[model samples]
Target: MSLRTRLTLLFTAIVSILLALFCGLLYGVAEQYRLREFHARLQAEATTAGHLLLGQERISLNLYKLMDRNQLTVLPDEELIIYNAQNRLVYESGTDYLALTPETLTRIRNEGKVVWREATREIVGILFTDQQRPYIIVASAVDTYGVRTVASLAQLLGIGWCVMTGLMLIAGRFFAGRMLKPISQINQRIDTITATSLSSRLPEGSQGDELTQLARRFNRMLNRLEEAFKLQRSFVSHASHELRTPLTAITGQLEVSLLAEDEPDELRATLRSVLDDVRGLNRMTNGLLELAKASMDASAVPMGPVQLDALLTQIQAKIQQLQPDYTIHLRIDPPDTHASDWQLTGSEALLRTAFFNLLDNGGKFSPDHTVWMQLIRQGTELQVTIHNTGVPIAPDQLPTIFSPFLRGRNANGHTGHGLGLALTERIIQLHQGQIRVDSSAEAGTTFTVSLPG
Candidate 1:
């Protein structure tokens, strides 16, 4: 069932049940009141009959019968009888006369009053005392008018219940539909939000309801999607441009060698040029693959405790071996000589790549071809600082240093695709670490990396 329909049915059922209970309670109370009123009338008739028999001297039975036939002191469907001390019937009025029992007589003599009831009929017996004898007066009746009133009340309650239940159903369905209107709107909006329209945001209402919060979250997700789309477009464009350069160079060189096949020297030079272009393409492809691997979340990357001091020693040796003319001085500091602050959980190869990139960047740019490195323990954190006495990167370009394919304007002779720092950033983020760089002409450039131990 639709939510609105179900809500309406539930409300109708609840109202119907409550109305039934209320009507039942009213009926019971009214029935009791009607019975009490009938009892009072029967009692009054009995008292009057007793008074008449006791007050008058030798009253005639015929006169009492006349009084009843005239309907002066008797009501319809009612009977009043007087019993003598010997349990003999002395007088009676009305129809359906109740036969007095010995048990009833004994009860009247002992208690002064006796009552009996069956279905809608009620009978009351009272013992009356006189100067010469004691007698009993009994009255019995059914309240026909009260019964009719109860039937009318039941009919009215049934009608009221039906009308009220109908009204509740209508109201409940309307309210339920109104409450779900916002969700319906949101669904419609979501339907229109596809990849082509990711820039479009979800509607955020001012009421600050749950629906509003949901819309806000959807809008935020759309923003991220839009950013990813732009980045993917840029990445594909740059990658294609970088790849086409090498292929074009290789093709041009091969065409030149084919056209000038007679000279052995020209053929060798052309092949070497083509080989260099091929090597550049391979290096770019490798860098792109590494960037992709580093971009994954930390949980997706394999992790292990790497000895920071050992890794630094290895990187220092590799850099020294690569650039025999360049000097790379490495220093380590801890609170104690044997402290375990050098150990941290991360991807060792990725971490090594990040450090090697910084070291390479420093050495490549240094006019003196010297890089100074230091690892220091600060509380629960370890910091590695790499300083180069090279040309300083422009101050304005610092913010965009870690952006993909972004290079400093001051970099003139550097041949790089600009993915090193960006890859380093991704790997550091995967390791839950931070990397920052500071550079100036007078003080040179320094790269600092901080990781938790």
Candidate 2:
């Protein structure tokens, strides 16, 4: 069933049950009042019969019988019976509907008064005394008027209960629809949003309710999606242009060499030029692959404790081996702790690649071919700084320095595909660390990295 229907049924069912209980209670009280009132009337009739038949101021037996015959009775189906102390019947209203027993008479004499029922008839018995002699009076009757009143009340209550239940059901359905109208509007608005219309935002009302919060969250997600789309477009455009350059150079050189039959030395020179271009192309391809790998979800990368001091030492040795003329100085400033303090949680290979790129850049951009590296322990963080004497980067280029395929004016004579810094930044971010760079004429160029220790 739909939510609105279910809500309506549940609301109606609860109120209906309470109403039924109230109607039943009212009927019971009315019935009990009718029975008590009728019993009182029967007792009065019994006392009156006793006084007239057995009291000192007695009425003639023949006169009382005449009065009863002339329609002077107090109740319908009324009967009266009187007995003296000798157990002899003295007077009767002339009715055979009620039969008195020895046990019943004894009870009435001992208790002084008693009342009981037999099917639809109510009976009352009382003790009477005149001149120190005892007598018993019994009266029986059916309450015809009271019974009709109670029956009519029951019929009325049943009809009212049914009518109220139906009205409540209708009211419940109308209110439930009003409560769900906001969600219906939200669904319609969501349908209008598509990939091409990421800028289209949901209307967030001033009401500080949960629905308004939901709309704000959706708008924030759309903002992130739009940013990602722009980055992807830029990445593809830059990669295509970079890849085509070296390939075109190699093709042109070979075509020209084949057209003219040059000497062996000239042909060898042309072939070597082509070989150099191919190597540069291969390096650029490898950088692009590494950059893509670093951009993946951080949870997918395997993690373990890596010693930053040891990883940096390895990078320094590897860089020097590749470029023998480059010089690297490494130093660590420990804070009175154990060797384990240098360890942090991350993917070791990725961290090593990140440090290698930073150290290589420091030496490549410096005039003296020298790079200085330092590690310091500060509270719960480990900070590393790499400094090199070089031409300072322009202030306008700081913001986009880590973006893919972006280079600065100081990078004119450098041999790189401009993917190294971007890959390094991504790897550090995957390890939940931060990397920042500062360059100026007074301090040369320096890169700082911070990681959880």
Candidate 3:
């Protein structure tokens, strides 16, 4: 069932049950009142009959019977009978509607007074004491007016119950719809949003309810998606341009070599140039793959304890092999350090690549062809600083220096695909580390990395 329908039914059922209980209680009390009031009237009439017939100044049976038959004193199908202490019947109203029994007379003598019902008839028996002797008064009547009154009340209550229940059902449905109207509107608004329409935000209502908070969070998610899309587009554009350069150079050199005179010396030089371009292309492709690996979930990356000092020393040898003209200096703060102090948990290959990028960039940018590397232990953190006494990067470019394929003006002479710094940042982030750079003419440029030890 629909939510609205269920709500309506539940609302109606609760109110109906409460209303039914009230009606039942009211009907029961009304029936009791009717019985009590009618029984009191019968008892009153019976007493009056005893006073007139069994008193010292007793009147004739005919005169008393005549007075008893009057409209005011008589009831519908009423019967009155009196008996002396001897259990003999003295007077009867001549209605013959009720038969006086010996057991009933004995009960009246023993109990003093009693009231009972027979079908629609109500009977009352009382022991009447006169100066002469004790007498018994028995009266029976069918309370036709009172019965009709109570029956009319029951009919009214039943009709009222039906009418009230139906009204409640209608009211329940109307209110339930009102309560759910906002959710319906929200669903409709959500349906209209698509990937292309990510900029379109949800309208937060003034109520400040849970639904409003939900809309606000969803809008924030859309903002992030839009930013990621823009970044991806820029990345693809730069990568295509960078790839086209080397491919074009290789193609041109091959075409020229194929057309030139087949001299061994010329052919070998052209083939060597093409091979260099191919190697550069391969290096860029590997860097792109490493960048992708670094951007994945940290939990998915292989991890183990790596000693920072040993890893940096290994990278130092590799960098020297690649560029024999560059000089790197390694420094450890508080020079005597324990092995455990230099250890941190991370992917060794990724960490190696990240530090290699920083050292290479420093040496490549420095006019003196030298890079300074320092590892300092700070509490549970390991801090590494790579400094170069080269031309400083422009102040404006520092903010986006780590962006993919972004090259600084100082990078004009450097042959690189610009994925190094971006890849390094991602790898550091995967290891729960922070990397930041400071550049100036006085300090040249320095990149700082901090990782948990």
TM-score, every prediction: 0.73, 0.73, 0.69
**Residue-level lDDT tens digits of model 1 in 1-453:** 876678778878887899889989998998889778878888888887777766556466778777767875456578888888988888777475466668878898899887778777788888887776798888888777888998899889889888988888888888888877888888898898888888777779899989899889888988888988988888888788888988998998788777765588777878888888888888888899999999876678889889889998999899888888778888887536664568898889999999999998888888877899999988888899999978888988999888777788756798788888989988888888899999998899999999988
lDDT per model vs. reference: 0.84, 0.89, 0.91
Question: Model 1: which residue pairs collide?
Answer: none
lDDT of 2 by residue, 333-423 (tens): 8545677989999999999989999999999999988999999987899999999989988899988899989998899988888899999
Instruction: Give me the runs in candidate 1 sitting further than 4 Å from their true place.
Output: 1-154, 297-299, 325-342, 372-389, 434-453
TM-score of 3: 0.69
Candidate 3 residue-wise lDDT, 255-296, digit = tens: 887787778988898899999999999999998899999999
Q: Provide the RMSD of all predictions against the true structure, rounded to 1 decimal.
A: 5.4, 5.5, 6.0
Q: What is the alpha-carbon RMSD of candidate 3 to the true structure?
A: 6.0
Best-fitting candidate, scored by lDDT: 3
